[model samples]
Target: MTAWIILPVSLSTFSITGIWIVYAMAVMNHHVCPVENWVYNDSCSDDTAKHGYPKSCCTLNDVPLISKCGTYPPESCLFSLIGNLGAFMVVLICVLRYSQVLEQSHRSWVNTTALIAGCTNAAGLIIVGNFQVDYAKSLHYIGAGVAFPAGLLFVCLQCVLTYHIAATTLDLWMAHVRVTLSALALISLVFSGIFFIHDSFLLQHLAAVCEWIFVIDILIFYGTFAYEFGGISRDTIVTAIQHASSRACKSPGSSSTSTHLHCNPEGITMI
Candidate 1:
């Protein structure tokens, strides 16, 4: 079995990939088929038979997600092949590299929760990667599952848990630092939450806010990873992170830090 860290990171990476696929399809003037119809274009579209209720034609809702996605055609798959494969490979690489660290790292409820979220996401990817992908498009059914944990539950936990982790540990400075940082991470979480509730990414489809939520969650995620790694890997994090395909975080970005976990040498910034 893979280590605990692998699970959360996998969830994050996979969810990000799902988002990327959707974003790409949208940009290409394609849309994910909500219904599941795979016949390219609106050619095979059958409205009366699709939804229980009959419609003029298969609007996006009528088309099957198994096949239809947005407005694009099957050729979109040829375009997204490279990016899709690469994202999966990256997920594999991250787990392999951190396998050792996860073995001996401290276990926490937050970590467990993140794992659960990741597994759910992985299941979704399996669908997108295997049966349903039209080039790079994903159903987001998987992405939403993963996002619930990292973007919602886990990010919140990082605050209280980081504070608790900090306060209880031998290092007073680190504890205080965690307390402050975790507190601040709450802010990002708030905006991210609002975006999702409204289905807007601070723009259209506020739900797309999920992209940044995970991005911010990663900072805190990295911090937790650092704590799990014990000594921390200054090198692994310093590199520029592309994040998920949908949206990329800024360079030299810090993962989510709670408002509470502030100060100390190993501050949230380090994450």
Candidate 2:
């Protein structure tokens, strides 16, 4: 059985799930989108009539996933930033320790992509949150504009890594699949970039679609972690092959007699 990947995986999962929960909370709370239409003042001008809105909406995003469904948007500063920050801390710790997982496989890409996305998302939020600008085109909006795409790119990178793990049929083909799937993310990102640069709605749509895809990607990646950490009984053919290869290399008269390795639980060994 492989060493436990439980701690880090669990922590990261909880962190992400918390954010999701917050989004759900925001959506259901006021029953109307908090930002569909509004005036320059912190008030919505004839909001319901103007936007044909039902008059209320909000989300927990806890920050990021706020219901696009309108303007006194319910903000969950508590969960949005503080909770996610705490979660990010846990995830960062795990990534630091487990970053080198799958030394012989493509796990490094997953780890790197995750680190980039999570760190950038959290950091970007921190900066935006502190800007004291809550209006449209405010510093927060600009920050989000920058951070969102970076996060998406890293997320696409994550999807690639996840696909690699999922399609790993005892060969390197999995990595190729990962790369291929990630290309879509890349394309979406590029289009989003072009749209944003030109200030087009096409970018917005692409981002929305990609956000859902990224979420799905996260879930798939979660399954990989679950197998790696929670379900110790499962073993990938790749890991087995690597193990066999290692044993073969360690045979008497081989050149590796001077080297020894111990299973380190904290180390997320991909191979």
Candidate 3:
């Protein structure tokens, strides 16, 4: 029932579901243009036809032939809204839970840095979602730049923390799994970046796919927190219940109190 368990589960379920919903809405709405229709030209309107590239999601200032997947009416708004909210919730939970995790561990400065990086990544995600690429290209790109790199940094930091804790307190297998996920995320992110930068249409498509992979990997990694938090929460509840029961049993003049402590140590009459 603690927020630690609730938040991680919420984040994992909402983010994965939300993004796919947005993608489905966009595609079903026919907002995406075919890859064969993409082109580069002086005018945004003319690029799709002249560039001789496959039809894809239209960028800002694209010609009439290109589909504006991210800018079309309710779908666009829905995508941004879901993305912004999801990012905010996930990051907030992570930040709050991170302190507890650190407290359980060695509480090193590196973990603190990871928390900061996670916050930065969250901020970047908010910015990216709010500022659609078509609406504000420069701002969108800036947000994306901040988000991707910071996200990678956060992942790396978490992986290191997991390894450190596993060596001492946590399960070694869990630590190994986290490290493996982080590595996969890192690799996917790198390829996504490269494909996004390349001029080829096919490369751009590959970049999009890689980006999805990167996101999925990160989400899965975050989902693992549910297991961690669940264990902690169970222990906390058990401890609290035991402590409360002990207090109740030790209370003066309680009918159910154990005979072992019936006599008061202070020799004072009970009210």
TM-scores for every predicted model = 0.36, 0.47, 0.71
lDDT (CA) for every model shown? 0.39, 0.45, 0.65
Write the residue-wise lDDT of candidate 2 on 209-253 in tens digits.
455455444333333443434333323434434544555656776
Give the runs in model 3 whose Cα sits over 4 Å from its true position. Answer: 1-3, 33-69, 167-170, 231-271
Best by TM-score: 3
lDDT of 1 by residue, 163-204 (tens): 444434554555555455445555654554565444221232
Of 1 and 2, the candidate ahead on TM-score is 2
- Ranked by lDDT, the better of candidates 1 and 2 is 2
For candidate 1, what is the TM-score? 0.36
What lDDT does candidate 1 reach at residue 123?
44
Task: List the candidate 2 regions with Cα displacement exceeding 4 Å.
Answer: 1-4, 7-16, 30-53, 56-75, 78-83, 86-94, 97-118, 128-168, 171-177, 191-207, 215-271
| Worst window of 10 by summed lDDT in candidate 3 | 60-69
The candidate 2 region of ten consecutive residues with least summed lDDT is: 58-67
Query: Which candidate ranks first by lDDT, i.e. highest?
Result: 3
lDDT of 3 by residue, 187-250 (tens): 9989988877876656666667678788878877777777567545444434334433556656
Better of 2 and 3 by TM-score: 3
